[model samples]
Target: MGGDHGLAVTIPAAVNLLRTHSHVFVHLVGQQVAIEQSLSRYRNLDPTRFAVVHANDVVTMDDPPAQALRGKKDSSMRVAINLVKEGVAQACVSAGNTGALMAIARFVLKTLPGIDRPAIATAMPTMHHGMSTVLDLGANVDCTAEHLLQFASMGSALVSALQGKMNPAVGLLNIGEEIIKGNDTVKQAAELLRQSNLNFYGNVEGNDIYKGTVDVVVCDGFVGNIALKASEGVAQLMSGTIRDEFQRSWFSRLCAVLAYPILRRVKRRLDHRRYNGASLLGLRGVVIKSHGSADAFAFECALVRAHDAVQNGLLEKITQAMVPLSAEADAA
Candidate 1:
């Protein structure tokens, strides 16, 4: 109900997931009539695996985060999250206002023990033919050294659970590989990460992200958000330029035909839709934030992510990793 196309994208994605995963159950939270109408379009849908919960209000993209939190108590976003809180659902996925989703999630699910704020963790495509998990992607603009350390722990645990990378290498995002490059907070965070039991790979420069020098990269929200948007812009620019050049002339069009298969592979490799669903880590419950403008395929990727996280016991893994940190905090 909150996304650009609302149920048009979500319902189809839900149907796809239900068809594919027999064990998965999806609770559609929105206006009953709209949901029913959407589901009616699909004749082969399994009605037993899907249920719709009515939500009277909707939190729009333009709505302020605080306003959405204070009001809109019956919004679909809120109801979906409540399902997670009530153990009726293992996770909640939404393509809605990021700020409102984060605010409401923090208020409802609360933060995990030893985590001051929840950081957004998402996989970024890398040149190494793999993905790097980067955290604090626009979740907390400012962060303390402790927060950065927490991000590293959460990210490491996430990669381990999702990617099956036990003790995955962790890197602190910095201006330089040298220890003296970044601000005091990052430098201090580096020290903490080094001392911890994680597989710290020292400071990693911006270029190292694409190099896949580490499995996990940790940064404050301000820097992580900038990096994410910049990389996305570059990908778009490159794709557009290639397309324009290919259409410039008859010869180029012929060349494009010859290179069609390779270009398709390249496009698939860099497709951001494949990497949709940013996890709001450090929360008590699983909440995935899909891009607000995501289409049906992209939204389906988000649902897959949420399902994978639940099946892999992401919450339990993060909780186990936080126990040592929580004890240390108490000792201090």
Candidate 2:
């Protein structure tokens, strides 16, 4: 109910997931009346598989993180997360305010044993016809070298679990590929990564992201968020230019008809909906943050992501990976 389109998009997505994934059960945490009204549209919904828990309030997009935490005790976002904390649900996915979700999640679920702060990790389509997991996407703005190393370790574990890669190569994002190029934090983090058991690939530039130079890329939240937004902007600009040029003239329309199949393939490749969910790694419970403006298809992608994370034992994998690292840290 907290998303941009509210139950209008989320309910349909939930219904679709229930229909397609027979192994999955959904607990809709929001106003029961609205949820029932939306579910009424789909006559074939299974009552046993889909249930709605009542939430009195909603954490709006504009609500400050602290205010949302203090005031909205019975909000949908908080209740959904509570389900995870209580082991009633394996994971929680929200398209609500990011700050509110993070604040409430950290408060309720808490961080993992060895993690200082949770980092946001998302899959980005790469030129190699694969995806790269980039972390610290607007979770922690300022990070120490230790935090960066933790992000790398968490990211490596995530990719291994979700992407089925053993010892996936990890890269530290920097201005240049040279070891001496980055700031103190990045340099220090690089040293830590190299000394660890991970498959560290040294420093990689911004262009390396699209090149798929590594399976995972690590950076501070401030830089990672900027890079993500800039890439999205460029994709939007290119899509718009293609649409405008195709509709400019009769000849262009004819060209568009002839090139329709190729354009469709390109569109599918770059569809943001395909990569809708951003996992908040380093949390004890799985929490996926869908884009606030996401459509039903995009929201469904987030649900699928949460489902996969639970089935793959993402939490267990991260915990096991961190045990040795924690011991090493203590020894040092």
Candidate 3:
């Protein structure tokens, strides 16, 4: 009831997830009649696998976060999060308004004990056919040195829990690899990371992100969001250029046909749909945000992320990782 395609995308994605994950149960939190109607389209689905939890309203894409938080308490987004808070659901996933989702989640679940704010963390594809987790991807545009340190801790926990790396290296994103290259806030954050228990790898440039220089890259939301969008732009441009070049002549068209198999594998390797979910880290409960324009496959990917986080004890891992930081603060 919230994303660009509403029931069309989400209902199919939920059905697909139930088919694959035997332990999963879905609560379709929207208008009960409409949700049931969509669920009826799919055949041979187990009735006990999911149930419709009625929601009276929806938070639109253009609604202000405050309005969604206060005025639309009964909206689908809010109701779903409420389920998480009530212990009825282990996690909440939404392809709805980002600001509204973040605001409502922070307000309802609150941040974890030692976390000042909740940062959005997602696994970014790297050159080595692996992934590096990056954080604060539009959650907090301005951050203090301490906030950056918090991001590093949460990101390390995410990578560890998901990828099975006990000590994931953390890198501070900067203009250059030099220690003195960044502004005061970043330099201060670097100093903090060095003294902490995390496996800090010092400064890394933008290009090093794809180079797999570290398992985690920490930055404020302003810079992180810009980097994310720029990378997306580059990927789209490269793909478009290759397609245009291959369509210019009969000889090129024949070459494209011959190279189709290799190109398909390459495309699958870097498919953005596989990495669709972004976790709202630092929240007391698990909540995932999906891209609003996602198709069924992409939405299913987001559901997979939410499922993995729960199965892997992501919340407990984050809490354990933050203990040293909390102790340091107490001593200071």
Among these predictions, the greatest lDDT belongs to 3
TM-scores of all candidate predictions against the true structure: 0.98, 0.98, 0.98
Residue lDDT tens for model 2, 188-243? 99999989988999999998888899999999999999999999999989899999
Q: Candidate 2: list runs displaced more than 4 Å.
A: none
Which of the two candidates, 2 or 3, achieves a greater lDDT against the reference? 3
Better of 1 and 2 by lDDT: 2
Candidate 3, run of 10 with poorest lDDT: 122-131
lDDT per residue (tens digit) for residues 140-234 in model 1: 99899999999999999899888988999999999889988999999999998888888999999888888899999999999999998998888
lDDT of 3 by residue, 131-228 (tens): 88888899999999999999999999998888889999999999988888999999999999999999999999888788889999999999999999
For model 3 the TM-score comes to 0.98
Model 2 residue pairs with clashes: none
